[model samples]
Target: MSIYIFDGTMTGLLSCIFRAFQFKEFDVQVSTDANVQTGLFAEVIDVASNDEHAQRVWQGLKLKASDSAFKQFYYAFLSEQQQAFQHCFNFAIYVFQQQRDVSKNYGHADVLGMSQWAKQVGREKHRMEAFVRFKKCQDGLFISLVSPDFNVLPIIERHFKARYQDQRWLIYDEKRNFGIYYDLHKVHQVQMDAGAIDRQTASGHSQSFCIELDDEEVLYDQLWKDYFRSVNIEARRNMKLHVQYVPRRYWRYMNEKTL
Candidate 1:
């Protein structure tokens, strides 16, 4: 058995996949940041990130799996589940051989786990698309923060870019510690702790905005609260149904409606 340690980036995982092909060994384990103790009986290999290798893996996936399946695979990778890594590896190899839709195939335990995790992560991604609320900054950049259950920072870029074509904005996932920055011209990944952009100045932009609440914004918020209180029917309140539809974790980010 051989153990391979990767840098834990998407590219690093792709590089490990390439090395796996070269080694041709069974009983392999993929890990990140964990050191392997040297022993006379085992071999340890370190894989380096290679864009070419990542692109090759991507190309093969594009051919063997549908676009949706590939997206599920990506989400499974971002799930941060240790066991999920091997499951992804096994699923990739299976797709290469089966050449059919194996997403629903629950014949294997690992496949079933990956399918469940993928579905969960994908659902969160869609919910974020619908529920994201951005706060406009002084520089006209819209910003919002979320701590998602999965690494959904990568999945939100396209939706915001297409929907807000003429705006500069950022939607940060505090859970994953990363964000997507869309500067109107293009969208790119950005490190969260790099710098600070004031969340209050409305400088050069003139479109309807959604911004973070501050002391000055209390009036608008109170108006919303008043509207919510006035419209609610106390007799129709169903706590169970409301909690079932919107989990408690998301309540902090919601406006007056769900509070």
Candidate 2:
């Protein structure tokens, strides 16, 4: 038994595949260094990320896999689940070992697992795109805090960048402790201390920012909440259905929900 530990990156995972073939190790378990399991009988191998090796494996997969299959594999990796990583690793191995396309082979556990994982990450990506709400800062920067179940900021960046091209915006993932910032020109990944944000805002309950907010932002929030209340039909309310569509976790980012 062989245990292949990687750095939990796409490149690292691909490098692991390259090393697996290089060493002729077929029976292997993939794990990130952070989640490595101890097995006294298993031979442990640490796969370092190598761009050349990764690209070689990627190019080979591209030749064997369809475009949709390629996307599914990438989306599954973005899920960042330990099990998903192992499935992705196995899926890559399966793709190279077989002569025919294996993407639609739902009978295979890795193939089916990758497909299901990709769908879940895709749904999270769309949800983040739809539910994200931003507030204007005194410095002309719009900021929003999010803690999505998956690492979805990478997938949702294009939507926000295209929609808010004229303004500077920051979408911070409190769970991941990183954010994407668009400077009206390009998008950049950023990291900062939570102290810069208001405790209430970070908690998803209050709009009071630690830093100065745009003077009209509070009025805008109130007006929006008032409009929401006015249009809400209390008698026709269906909490169960509403919560089904918009889960309780997302309520923190909604102004009407906070009110």
**What's the CA RMSD of model 2 in angstroms?**
1.7
Residue-pair clash count for candidate 2: 0
Clashes of each: 2, 0
Clashing pairs in 1: 135-211, 138-201
Model 2, 53-137: lDDT tens digits are 9999999989988888888999999998889988888998898999999877889999999999999999999888888889999
Clashing pairs in 2: none
Local distance difference test scores for all models = 0.71, 0.88
Task: Evaluate model 2: give its TM-score.
Answer: 0.94
- Give me the runs in candidate 1 sitting further than 4 Å from their true place: 35-42, 97-104, 194-216, 257-259
Worst 10 residues of 1 by lDDT: 199-208
Q: After TM-score superposition, what is the CA distance of residue 32 in candidate 2 from its true location, in Å?
A: 1.6
Model 2 misplaced stretches (Cα beyond 4 Å): 199-204
The CA lDDT at 149 in model 2 is 91
Candidate 2 positional error at 241, Å: 0.8
Residue 217's lDDT in candidate 1: 46
